[model samples]
Target: MALKWVKDNALNLGGSPDHITIFGEGAGAASVGFHMLSPMSRDLFTNAIMQSSSPTSYWAVKGTQETSARVATLAASVSCPVSLGDALLPCLRAVDAKLLTDQQWTLVNRWFDVPIGPIVDGAFLPSHPEDMLKAGDIKKTNVLMGVNLNEGIFWIYSFAANMPLDKEGATDKEQFRNIVLAIADNNATLQTELLKVYSKEFADAQKRRIRILDAASGDSLFKCSVVDFARQYTELGGRVHLYSFEEKLTSNPWPGWMGVLQGYEIEVVFGLPLNNGSTNTQAEKDLTKEVMGLWTSFAKTGTPEFGEVEWPMYSTETEDYVKIRTKGTTVARRLRSHACAVWAGHQFP
Candidate 1:
């Protein structure tokens, strides 16, 4: 409805309906994926840019029974009677909105678990996202999708204050294993496989342990699924420009240990450094221009080809992706191939 409204009134609003490009980050990025897959949203947008999320990500959708269970739990928390069937909606509607919103966090079983998300409603979703992708049931459009180098640090730092870090503020082997177990849902085989994939081989034990945990968390939660989506989409003959946000800005407020954290690309994508009263370095400002140009150019031409670096179309064989950096953008192959293969073996949903 929203997209239709925009399309219907684009000329009246001094915009072109024929040239819409939808883009978002995190959940919003997942939403762009949903729009891409949804029949109701077909022809609403000509291109999409998904950053750090994918519709096929494990947390992006829940099984129907699980979604219903979560809704019942939420309703129970607010004294709404879920057993009342049709009455439940009104009961939930009667509850204070802020109170209902506050109860959502209690539904989380793990740091990465999203209690509320899209479901296979047989209408909007039509089928499982993975199934849809496999059958090529998604809209054929230009796709731009990628993730950050250390996406997991965002989640780790969220609970870091309550976590037990060493004097050097790094994770130990035991702590790292515990984190991998949580990410693997306490499955021993999966945990062992994850540990092997992100092995503790670095000479520095502190950095090794931390990096292991970070890689496990980031790959399981974001990168692998995004890659899977790209591969599936490309196999279906869709144009995809894959990328990795590798730059950690000098003006980054997070600890130096959190390398290229999730959502860090937002600043450059939106030209935050070029804003008034900004203290970003000249290099960052230049990078921001380059990034914004790529995004706008993609929206305008369905290709992010700008400047010296030639961004290649992703394929299952090559799995090429652009590494966006403050120094310069360069093409890289097989982003996390080994780790993604490990995840590919595991069944999601």
Candidate 2:
């Protein structure tokens, strides 16, 4: 309906309806992807830009059953009458916004550990996203999507700060093991295999357990799923442009080793002068300009033409992408396929 309005009113506002692009980042990116997969929204948007998110992301995509449970929990938390069934929507609507929001956050943090995101509710999402994409339910829109290098660093940092470990390695070790077990359904064999792989990677680290868990969280939580979505979409003959945002901020925002933490692309993409209180360098400004141009041009046309490098459409054979960097932007191929393969064994939800 909103897209319809935009299409109808674009010409009056001196814009072309045919040039409409639906772009979003983070969970908003998930929304964009959701629209792409929705049968009702086919060709409503000419192009899409999804950064740091995709339909395959576990937390971003939820089941209707879980969504119902969450709704019940939120209602109960706010002292609403859950047994009313048909009357629940009106009851919830009448609750004070602040009270409802607080209760919802409390329930979300207590049980899920992650914020509530979009759910597959049969109508908007006819089936699981994997099924939808595999069965060719996605619009063949031009897509630009990618992830940050260390998207999970700040997540771990938050966990560490809130749940202070008694000893550096020992407490984190146990916690990491428990986390892996919880994620793997207490499967001893899977837990052991995951630990072994991570142990080998962080063999000489000062904080071995932290590094191991961070790697697992980042890859499993976002990167692998993103790669899977991109691969499936590309195989379906979509014009996909992938990228990796590798530019570290001049001054780190989050404390302790937040290597390209999630959403870092926002400032650079918008050509913001200050990044966490540090002034942008000339190189950073130039890179920002290039990024803005590529994104805007892709919205106008279903192609990204940036500088000397013509960013190629991602194919099953090449899996190519343009690497965004403050120093230099260049074409690079493949995501962390090896790490992704490791996560694939666990069959991440």
Candidate 3:
């Protein structure tokens, strides 16, 4: 309805309905993916740009049973009668909005679990996102999608902050093992595979553990799904230009460990470094301009190609993408092939 309203009023708003470009970052990007797959949203947009997300991402959608359970939990918490079925809506609506928002956090039980998200609704989302993509049921549009180099670091930071830790104030070896087991759902085969795949050669046990967790979390949560989406979409004859955000700015406020964290690209994409009060370096300013140019060019022309950098269309054959950074943008192939292979058929909980 929001997209429809925009299309309906584009002329009065000094925009063109024929050139609508729907773009988003993180969960917003996932929403863009859902729009592409939803029949009701077909013809609503001409192009899309998804940063650090995919419709098929594990946490992007919830099952009907799980969603119902969450709703019941939320209703019960606010003194609403869950057993009343249809009566619950009015009761929930009567509760204070801020109270309900605060209680939603209690629904999250694990590090990567998202209690509230899109579901397989009969209308907006007719089926699983993976099924839709594989069946070629999605609206074909020029798409620019990619993930950050260290997307999982943010999760690691969150886990360390929220989850219980040993006296050393770090995730011990046993704690790390247990987290991996929980992530693998206690499947012995998967546990072994994960340990083998994420093993690091670093001599320091703590450093090795952190790096392994970072890689596993990033791959399972973001990188793999984005790659899989690109492959599936391209297989269906959809044009896609994939990318990897590798730039880490000196002005970043987060700990150095959180390298190229999720949502970091937003500032650069919007040319924030060029702002009047920004402390970003000249190089960052230049990169911001280039990034803004790429984004705007794509929004206007359905292609990100600008200046001397040639971004080849992503495909299963080439698996090509441009690595955005301060040094210089370079073409890299087969992003995380080994890690993606390990996560290929398996769905993370």
Candidate 4:
């Protein structure tokens, strides 16, 4: 309905937007990424700004039917005091969004982690988003996918605070290491590697490296689908414009000084001076203006250049993306890490 609405509206207005870019933050970005490949939305929006988030189709929450049944079965196994029946579950979608937010983030995690999704509900989202991307149905849209330099700093504070790298290191000889590794299905090798990456902070750190890991988390959680979309789309005659954000954030006098963390780019990308209690220094604002122009121009035209670099189409042959930073704007065919490359190789349902 969303894509059809856009296409129909654009057609009514005239031809589709030459650029037709989509803008979204957090889960909104995830939706935009998915919608790019969605059967209903492919050409509706041609360009996208997946700010601080991306397609997280790799993770799925347990569905209502399955989860409810499991909860019931588990309850029964424990001699559950509650009744186990169809009436037990009123269906999650029935709940109001406000109520869910007021209830806090566990529900959101359940939707993403417990249930494997966009969903296979047999209607709007009949199959997984990655399926659409893999089939090359998603290529009509170009993309400006990126994550903030401190994208995962919040997650680190939320989850990994008070823990040292060695503790976080799955390679550690500690039980805690084993526990964290078990979460990734006890892939000790991967866990050991993750410990090396997450637990160990190398001095060779580019400011964006940690963010890239969080971006990889976004990649694993949300970006894999779009990775497929970008790769397959270009391979099958579509275009994708990729970028990485390296905006500098002003540190405040808080206990811990966190920079442009998750969702912080929302203001910067749109060139809105945010209330981080810091002034948008002229240099920062200049960079902000540059990005906003590129983004909105792409939204209006399907290209991301606003008197910037020559916007290139992402092709299988030329696997590169324009790197967006305060220092410069250039087409970087590769990042130091193979995270995005590795992500593109996964199989989608």
User: For model 4, what is the C-alpha lDDT against the true structure?
Assistant: 0.54
Among residues 3 or more apart in sequence or in different chains, the pairs in candidate 1 whose N, CA or C atoms overlap within 3 Å are none
lDDT per residue for candidate 2 within 1-349, as digits (tens), equals 9988888898998989888998778778888889999877766768889988887777778776767788888888877776648889889999999887777766553312554567778888898888998998899878988888777666665655544544444345567777666544466887787788778877766677766666777877778887888889988888889988888866446543546888888877776843455576777777878888988888888888787887888887888888888777888887877667777877544
Residue-level lDDT of model 3, residues 266-322, one tens digit each, is: 989977789898898898999999999999899889999667879999989989998
Worst 10 residues of 2 by lDDT: 107-116
| Tens-digit lDDT track of model 4 for 1-349 | 6556666687677766444566787678777766665555655665666764555445432234754544554344334333555644454335466753344333333212432234445454555555555565454655676555555445544554454443222222464453344333445565555545544444534433343344435445544444544566567676667666766545322223355556666667655654455576766777778877877777776677755378676666666766666677777764323554444444322
Estimate every model's Cα lDDT from 0 to 1.
Answer: 0.85, 0.76, 0.85, 0.54
> What TM-score does candidate 1 reach?
0.94
- What is the RMSD of candidate 3? 2.6
Better of 3 and 4 by TM-score: 3
How do these models rank on TM-score, best leading?
1, 3, 2, 4
TM-score of each: 0.94, 0.88, 0.93, 0.70
The alpha-carbon RMSD values of the candidates against the true structure, listed in the order shown, are 1.9, 3.1, 2.6, 5.9
Between which residue pairs do clashes occur in model 3?
A: none
Candidate 2 or 3, higher lDDT?
A: 3
Reference-based lDDT, residue 28, model 3: 93
Cα distance off (Å), candidate 3, residue 4: 1.0
Candidate 3 lDDT score at position 23: 93
Give the candidates in order of lDDT, highest first.
3, 1, 2, 4
Give per-residue lDDT, candidate 3, residue 288: 91
